[model samples]
Target: MNHTIQNLEASFQDVKSENSVLKDKIYSLNSSFYQYNFTYSDSFQRQKQFDELQLLQQQQDYMIESMNHTFQNLEASFRDVQSANGVLNGRLDSLNSSFLQQNHSSVDYITKELQLQTQNLSLSLMELNKSRSEDIETLRNIIRSREQDVPKNITSVVNSLKLNDRYLSLSLLDLQNNISMIGTLLQEQQRIQSNQHKLLQMEIQNLTYSFNKSTILLSNLQTRQETTVAFTAGVCNIPGDNKVFSPGQTVIFRQIIYQVGGGYNPSSGIFTAPKTGLYVIFCTNVAEYHETFWTKIMINGSAKAGVMALLRSSNVYIYQSASNLVVHLLQMGDRVWIQVRSGNHLCSDSPETTFSVVMINGSF
Candidate 1:
């Protein structure tokens, strides 16, 4: 009986030791599970952020491609317009040439006709004068030969001479009237030509204005298409374990996630505006527990926005984060940066302290 009781007590002691060991194993497993869960959560968050960034990039690419397609269409249209204008100009030049040729030919024909008419009139006048002189000589010879019948013959010859004189005066008056009519025709033709030249000048001025307007529009569109700006940077594993900055000190984000149009400089911790435009800026900062982090977004040495991360609790191994966003108009050559305001310490981990800037629209 004593031996059986001693065996039972030994068995009980062994069972207790085994139960304690199993409890320790369970606790260790639970702790490991918690650590793994935290790691998974952190990884998931990072992946989410990465995905968002990729999505943004893809959207930007799509927009750029669409803009390029639109620009191509515009260029094609402009080319067509230019081609049509050239055709119109060619037609106008041909018409103008035809008009000038017709006008010159008409003037030349009128001048030649007037000169020929004048020569004919002069020849007729000369023939008439020669006929009159011959008649007078014949009459005189008759008068001398018939001196006995002088009175009757003389009266008949005088009547004949007066009739010829009246006919000559009527012919001279007709020639003068013809000359006056030719002068009037020339004046009317000159006036018509002047009016046509004025009309052509006005048409040319209108076409020139339209062409200049189209050129300006195309230039503006091209400028808008060519301007593309976006960048994201972070402070990842900074050297020497010093992540603090004095007041008015700029925060340098050494890790470059992405950059487009080349405005952000990691070394200088500043972004120079490549073009005048409206820009959207985002900043995030992280600080350790029991500390405060203060930062501001600066443009040309002036603060545009600010954020604070205050973790005053007596908690160890914890962090607090703050973020700020600003939309501001920037001119080309303007400088932008993030500066420390009050508290100086910032986390050096990737994605925890980040700054990003993107151009929204260009100035008109």
Candidate 2:
């Protein structure tokens, strides 16, 4: 039993190992599934980010181009104003000479206004250049930050996958251990059943030995009682030829032949016990050629012993006989008889087919 248990444990371990390997394969498949999804999703998100970045970069470039165009337009407008002021100054100088003191006050006021307008335009150009430089610097900083964030996000995703893989491996190991434990429990159950069967066999052997001892003691007691016992004997004789019978039908004999006691009843084909005792019952079964028949010794509608006969259908008209002898304990009033269990044409051509019962021992 110990060896069997060990072998079972070894087999269970092997199975556990195989299951562990399968779990590893399953984990690998799951990891692959997760990886595929992550890759697809990350790639999609990265593509979207890249598209957004590209759009931002394009917008920045367009803004820069628009600023450059505005600066050029501003420079052209300043140049046109300078040329117009020079021509106007030349005309004012000619008018002042021609009108003398009368136009001198008006020329001075007009010159001052032109100088103020030129200073305001110069200040606006300087402010526009500064704003453009600041915008360019801000765009550069944004590009640098986005480049740094991409690597950080990728690393985080990879770490999460590794963590998931570890968890799956641990769970698989636990399941494998659980299966191994269940296998051990099953082995214990089988060992228990085996032990129970052995115990049952030992008990049966003890009962049989006790029964045989009691039977021998009873027989010895009957032997001592034999001097005071009355004798009882009965015999049946069959003389018909080619008698057909069906299954479960009693085999009746017309002649009691030699019954010394009132136990035998010819009409009912049965014998009732006059006293409780061990009795030896015997039967001789005869069958026709090429026919098979089954005969059973019955007690109160239940068969106790049986015999089967088969005869070879040869040209010589061969007859066959099967016999059975059984010893049974019967109580007073219990009936014993013989019946045909199976056959078609069963008969007795002579007095060879017979049934008999004799008391072998008296009740103890």
Candidate 3:
């Protein structure tokens, strides 16, 4: 409302300024008449009246021009704002796409890198034992060299081989440690990537919420401006009179709520729906434009619009199967209720007015 008023004020100011300018222009364009034999008082009064008429004419022209200009400006600005909003939304979508693509690529690359690392670690272990055949041959040579031919340096030679073996063992241990470190690093990276993905998702969700809120705000503002057609549900003075009905799904009333099946008890004025399905129950009172309490289906105790009803062409049968009972069930605690929708506003003077429910075999 405030925004609408502000725009109107701005438009009015522009028109006023334009009107003043047009008046000045018209005055400048007009020629001053000089009469040789005219009396001063009468002639001056006639000239003043002519000038006033011209000024009024100019004011009219100014108003028309200003209205056109203001409308054009407003239209252009609205278009620009819409364009900007679209671009922002597009960019946000692109960011989401980029994030998903990036994560996918990262995962692929990480998998490849891990595979390569594993291969290299295995190769390193293989290389470490490549000289096993030569080591075995050297030991055999040492054994055949005999006790008699053995020099005093033989002990030293054996000690040297044992030292080499110890060195080889330490090297192998170091290589294994390197492989383990690489595995740990890769695992750490995966964890970090997962956390990043989660953060991105949270940010996207927040952005979506903000975008929706802003869009709704803009729409509401626009709606409040320009034009609006109001919808007012007519009132009926049923002080305490109310209603209920059930097939749990389908209930139809021409004028009065029959409360058919297990839940519809016109006498008690209470409806109980046992199962789930479309229920079309309506009320007739001294009201206009607000009729039909057409609730198609009640799942458990909630109303479902029957998204598949159109496809399935499926509907339920509602009738008073028992004594003042509609399916012996209660249709209560469901969403999509119009205060004007619960069939009727029960008159406080009436006995008890409520809807009931029970389980029944029906498809919707």
Whole-model Cα lDDT of every candidate shown, in order: 0.68, 0.64, 0.41
Candidate 3 lDDT, 240-320, residue by residue in tens = 423343224233221232223333433333344434454443322221122223223333445433211111112532211
Top candidate by lDDT: 1
TM-score of each: 0.37, 0.34, 0.20
Cα RMSD (Å) per model? 68.4, 30.3, 61.2
Off by over 4 Å in 2: 1-242, 312-317
Write one digit per residue (lDDT tens) for candidate 2, span 54-153: 4644554564455456445545644554565566567657765655755777767766765676566456545644554464455445444544553454
Best by TM-score: 1
Q: Could you give the candidate ranking by lDDT, starting with the highest? A: 1, 2, 3
**C-alpha RMSD of candidate 1:** 68.4
Cα lDDT of candidate 1 equals 0.68
Among all windows of ten consecutive residues in candidate 1, which has the lowest summed lDDT? 145-154
lDDT of 1 by residue, 127-179 (tens): 53454345434434533443334334334433544455456568679988998
Q: How many clashes would you count in candidate 2?
A: 0
